[model samples]
Target: MSERRPTLRERQRSETRRVIQAHAVRLFTDRGYDAVTVADVAKAADVSAMTVFRHFPTKEDLVLIDQPARLIAERVAASPATHPLVRRVGGALVDAATALTGRDGDEPAANERFLLDCLRLMVSTPALRARHLDSQYALQQAIVDALGDDTADPDTAFRAQAATGACLAAMHTALTRWAEDNGQTELPELIARALAASFGDDVVATGRRD
Candidate 1:
């Protein structure tokens, strides 16, 4: 089957979202996250405040905009059915890191300062930090849905949660470490290394005892 392309409205919506995000980032960088309001972002982006809210449901979402839930879900949905759940999630995260870093392979994006700044803001702001935790739980639930019907079984659900937690915990560790390092290191590398360190030789193995 041929893949579906986005409609014109969808394209326009995406472009508008990008414009709003760019403006919001600049505003946040200049005046700090708490100081800038959604109205300020709307004015800078040359759109109405309602439009800004339509694009980003919350003020903190302007900076925490990357859709980790959707990204991981799509990759998990695309994986081969026979693949182990843990490996599928691990591979999904590697793919997500690559996409986030804007590289097909191991290379990183040229300009990650903006992302680092956004992460820093998320760290320092209580609202954004809380939203970050919410996002993580949402991502885990998305992963559970993508991992198929087996999650309905109690044992399978436990394994699913373990696998999801391990992968996401690795990702969070990598993000914090990268921000602390001032982004001197490539984010994709840090993410990959963190995943490897967490899973070691058995990315497919769930930590459940028999």
Candidate 2:
């Protein structure tokens, strides 16, 4: 089935968000996250402070707002049910990250720069680093919701949630390394390597592990 195009309102909201984020990041970069206020971002975006708040609730959110929880959940839900939970969630997470970044090592330079800046902001700033945990929790909840009927089963829920947590941790490590290396290396490869090292083939690969 063909994907539905975004409606006019959706497009407008996205543009508004883009403008707000661009202004926010530039200001944050130029003056530092601590120094720049939401009012500053709002003014820079040529919008009201309320408009900026509507798009980004907390100051930390402007930097940490790109979590692809819905995308990850959708991918996991659409995957074959027969697959192992870890593989399904891990593959979905990887695919979602790849989708945001385009080809393995070749995301558009601007997009890559944006991600690098966000990653650096999250890593270097103490408050953003603390808020990062909440984003991870939100991602975990998304995976659990994607499990659907499986979430009702205690053992299945436990396993699914565990896998989600582990996968998110692996992803965090990969992202941090990507920032550390200045995005020179491919992110998908880093993420894949992290998952493999953390989970081993038995859990990460498909089919029975006999």
Candidate 3:
């Protein structure tokens, strides 16, 4: 089936959200995340406070709004079922990381600095850390759902959550290292190394066990 295009209203809302995000990044970077209010972001974006809230419900969201986890979940859900489950899920996260690093144009070179700043802010903020944990839980559930298994059983749910946690850990380690390097290394390269460190050289390999 052909893909349905976004409506004009949808496009407008997306653009507005982007504008608000950009403005929020600038303000947060200049004044610090804790100091910047939602109203401040709205003022910078030339939008109402209500509009800012509509796009990003909380102050922390201005930095944490990117949906890499959700995108990874979608990729896992859409992966070929013939592959081994580990390979499919890990490959989906790798794909999502690549897309997030701008392989698919979701990120741009200009935004890398902004992203780094936001990452630093999240690292230092307690509330943002809690929100991040909440996001991670949602992402974990998403991965379990994508696996197409009956995860109602405690053991089944635990395994699914464990695998998802590992994937997220790899991505987090890579991102933290990349930020520490001040954008000198390509994000995808670091991501690959981190995943390999966790799962060995054939991180996403679907080969039979020896």
Candidate 4:
């Protein structure tokens, strides 16, 4: 069965976000992220600052909007938690990394360029780097919820949170290194290696533990 197409409203919203982000990136790259204001981005995109804020709550969000929190949560929710928590969390994050990097290995070349620019900005900007840590907490909570761990059980909660944290930390290391390398290495491979190192040989290229 074919997947349902997005509604007209959803399509328009997505297009608006795309246009705003494009203009924002251009301005930031041309005139340093610190020098460019949200008002500057709005003027370049020909939209109001209100519109920009509605789409991206903060200036840092314009560079860091595309996180994998929802994707990871959904993937974790789809699987049964019969396996070890570390394996479940590790597998989910590794799978999200593969999807973002390119499942078919044919994601547009333009997207690769865009990601590299965004990653570079995040690495160099102090405000964006700080905001990035906040996003990490949100993503960890999402995974914890998806796993449906018993919040009242101290041991179970710690295990769930620890597993998610370790996986996220591994992915974060891989991503930062990728930015430093200027995207020279394949992202999925870096993520796979990082997870394998953290998990001690359980993670595979396919992101399957079994």
Candidate 5:
């Protein structure tokens, strides 16, 4: 027989995973992360607690699991080969933001609200906060590896880490400010302003080089 594709069992497993994640997010949002237990998620998902754990090793993983790590990696990889690493990464971020915002705009606003709620939970819950920071650090390291120069003595690793950290900090600051402002302003605009301020004229100059 030819190599077997995903069987019905596999499909069902995948669906179960999605359902568990959906229920977990709902419980986290409604009851708060700490208040919601694995049993609660299981009840909401109509699955057993073991199934939930099978999908996500920890409760915090459920919240952070769907983050777009692969998408970010792909965006960085798709940048112009001739561009400087920092410029390429920055351009990739802009592109990612545009892709995420959607054409009509309301979708992006909804997403921002959801993200804000998630961040707020992370901040209030110690375990979730630790997991969030750990996840972010891992992403930063991945970006740094993507930007590293093979021939440079000390390498561009430090710059990559700094740039990625700065970008993330800018976005977090913008989101927190927007949350405090009662969602009066558009998140994309705030993000753009933050990027401009952080990167200054380098953004324009970098774009021109391409």
Candidate 6:
């Protein structure tokens, strides 16, 4: 007989990972990142320390997670080549915002709060801050890879870096402003305005040039 696939068990395990990560974030945010040991997190989540380590190798990963980076990469990869990288990235951001907005029945408020918590942790914790820089560097590499080697010459690389950096800066700035504004306006609108300010009318024009 053929070996049975473990799809159901795998999904249960995946859900467990998410649960552990969620509890870890809650503990880390409520206490301090440095103050919360893996053992403490495991106990809080009702899992063993080994189980926590299985899900997140490092304490920092507990806060950083993987969904956002993976989603951004997938979006970039799936975008059309006819569009400029800037427009493609912008469109990806819009898609991400829509996903977060719960138009597809996902919980936007909860996800927003999770992002806010992540931003807070990344800014406030030294270890997490370093991890954030590493993540951005990885993102830069991914952008270059997506653009392809033929298009990743020095000039193209520079432009890609600048474009990605501008978008990230705009995102951080918008999120900060939104936090200060008590989230009066939705994140998507803030993100759109920020991107427009960064790219101006030049997005299409720049992309069309030889």
RMSD of each candidate? Answer: 4.3, 3.1, 3.7, 2.7, 4.2, 5.0
What TM-score, computed on C-alpha atoms, does each candidate reach?
Answer: 0.86, 0.89, 0.86, 0.87, 0.78, 0.81
Q: Pick out the ten consecutive residues of candidate 4 with the lowest summed lDDT.
A: 101-110
**Local accuracy of candidate 4 as per-residue lDDT tens digits, 21-131:** 988887887889999999999998899999999999888889875557887888888766577776777777777766666523544356666777887887788998898
* Best by the lDDT measure: 2
Supply candidate 4's per-residue lDDT for 128. Answer: 81
The lDDT values for all models are: 0.80, 0.82, 0.76, 0.80, 0.68, 0.73
- Per-residue CA lDDT of model 1 for 77-158, tens digit only, reads 8877676776788778777765766643544454366678778888878888999898888889889889888688989999
In model 2, what lDDT does residue 13 have?
100
Provide the lDDT at 122 for model 5. Answer: 71
TM-score of 1: 0.86
Stretches of candidate 4 off by over 4 Å are: 1-5, 103-108, 149-152
Return model 4's CA RMSD, one decimal: 2.7
Residue 123 local lDDT, model 2:
88
Worst 10 residues of 1 by lDDT: 201-210
lDDT of 6 by residue, 1-210 (tens): 998777997988999888888887888889978988999989988999999988888888888756666666667677777777787676566556546644224434776777767777787899998998898777766765766652557887788777777777776677677667655577767777777788875652332223
**Clash totals for all candidate models:** 0, 0, 0, 0, 0, 0
Q: Which stretches of candidate 6 lie over 4 Å from their true place?
A: 1-6, 101-108, 149-155, 201-210
lDDT of 2 at 60: 85
Which of the two candidates, 1 or 5, achieves a greater lDDT against the reference?
1
Q: Please estimate how well model 3 matches the true structure, expressed as its whole-model Cα lDDT.
A: 0.76
- Where is the poorest 10-residue window by lDDT in model 2? 201-210
| Candidate 6 lowest-lDDT run of ten | 201-210
Error of 2 at 43 (Å): 1.9
lDDT of 3 by residue, 52-133 (tens): 9999987878878557767777888777767655666677777776666563244346656667777776776788878877
Which scores higher on TM-score, 2 or 6?
Answer: 2
Highest TM-score among the candidates is held by which one? 2
